[model samples]
Target: MAAVGGLADDRALLGRTSTAERVSDILRTRIAEGFFPPGTRLSEDSIGGALGVSRNTLREAFRLLTHERLLEHQLNRGVFVRVLTVEDVEDIYRARRLVECAVVRGLGAPPFALDGIAGAVADGLRAAAEKKWKGVSTANIHFHRELVALAGSARMDELMRTVFAELRLAFHVVDDPRGLHQPYLERNQRILDTLRKGDAAHAERLLADYLQDSLAGLLEVYRRRVGADG
Candidate 1:
């Protein structure tokens, strides 16, 4: 029954949208940002009061997230943030491999600009140097977001945002943020460096292998924490 902080600010910023959609989006972003950790019980009264929404409106928002697989409602235990399983970790990486590598492979065919990708890399490097592991994690998320942006499809961008948000739930299970993110910083740079050489094939291969290794590692951590219960 530990209530997460920060909803007050988001609630104030929730201005002028369908109340249910706004509540759902705020909750989704909270879950994505790890403000609402896996398995945290969500109290309808608490959240509805905080967001200044009616119980019915809050319930609708909860239903939306439940449909999105970001939240689950127990028979009598109320709703909780979805804790991803090892299988979910595997499936997400599978999706990432197909999408991210394809985007990289298409580089230079229409010549996707590297500006956004480079910016993400620079952010990760800067965050790493500052010893901000959470910043590095955020930057890593940004890097992948920028990678998906290469496709130039608004729909793909929207899909990746959801995918990455779900992915972040799994990432929260890792105890050592630095251990999880440090190695990837250099790997991210290498991928950027490889792409800079205009070798899409090599870059794609590198990205695929990177995702595979990451998937295996995450599965191990997920098994230890969430197990088969997800």
Candidate 2:
């Protein structure tokens, strides 16, 4: 009987491994897909039960996501999806533009990783065409991230991960991602063209303007949502 009980426990543990992974995937998709909007309450008991996992395992998954900045935890009230303010958006874009534009200028054009950036842009265009807004957003983020990575600054890359995650939270507030992302497809191509031409200075200026315009549009939508929700 003891041996049977031990076997059952092992099966339960195995089941938990699967459940945690599924929970992570589900939460990521929901957040990215905007099903769980910013500031939405996340009940461990409810979500864990729904996903067929123990509370401990669910907590572990939540911790991982929180570290990624996709979720926030409040004492006593439990976890909630992160919400981005206008100020938050401004700060993120400021840091991103500063770091990324500097990276571009510093690269000085030495046969850097254009292929990776081009591939990401291509993937983003395809995702945009298919109306997969989340995928498009992620791909677009990756394109710029790789651009910064060209400078070989590990710290900048890490900073970008945090900024991008928060930016995704802001994106959840907006309704039309295609309207937001589609206009930039051509802009990205232009930036790539400049970079490929080894004109890093020109690329930096174009990237700055692009960041400004994009942030303005996003903030307008974000403010409107905050007003409506308030």
Candidate 3:
């Protein structure tokens, strides 16, 4: 997990936004980055002191993330990252399949700037080679982010960011990271390859199938975890 303190590195954000907004942005980024995993308690004093903000400001920040469904407030226990259910995982993939596949299908041609998407795929390949499963997971997230960027809409990108952040909560619940992420590395390359060939229809089909398989596997894992707890 990345350091929570890394949030303070953005000097420009510090200079511009209100204290609560600034803290919320930092915490939101950390949560999206998987620095604070599901069920990890967030201490008011600790985060407030670290960010140099008041406890009141930190609580407001927490409220913002809670509204985003990234953090949940438990009475008496304080704030912790949200833990997603199997249904939540299915809904996330449902949205991803709709948006991401539509983006690919709607692309009428190629020779588009694909540097970011390709870079993300390469990053995932390298991380898998190094056996860094967590890095692979992060790179996979980046790959999807870049995939959505092909649509070229700021509003769509923002919506996908929120979706991806919520998806990360489900990912944190997986017991086998490799089992969750390794197979998709090559599939990502295949999608890019199909796109490069200008076969948008085929690429869309591949993406839909990919999401189906991923969602099925994730649901199984989530159900197993719940069963074990029972």
lDDT, candidate 3, 56-91, per-residue tens: 778888888898889898888889998886667778
Which consecutive 10 residues in model 1 have the weakest lDDT in total?
1-10
Q: Give one digit per residue, the lDDT tens place, for model 1 in 163-211.
A: 8888888988888888788889888898888777777898889888889
TM-score ranking, best first: 1, 3, 2
lDDT of each: 0.85, 0.82, 0.86
lDDT of 2: 0.82
TM-score for all models, in order of appearance: 0.88, 0.79, 0.87
lDDT of 2 at 61: 79
TM-score of 3: 0.87
lDDT of predicted model 3: 0.86
lDDT of candidate model 1 versus the reference: 0.85
Q: How displaced is residue 183 in candidate 2, in Å?
A: 0.6
- Give the count of colliding residue pairs in each prediction: 0, 0, 0
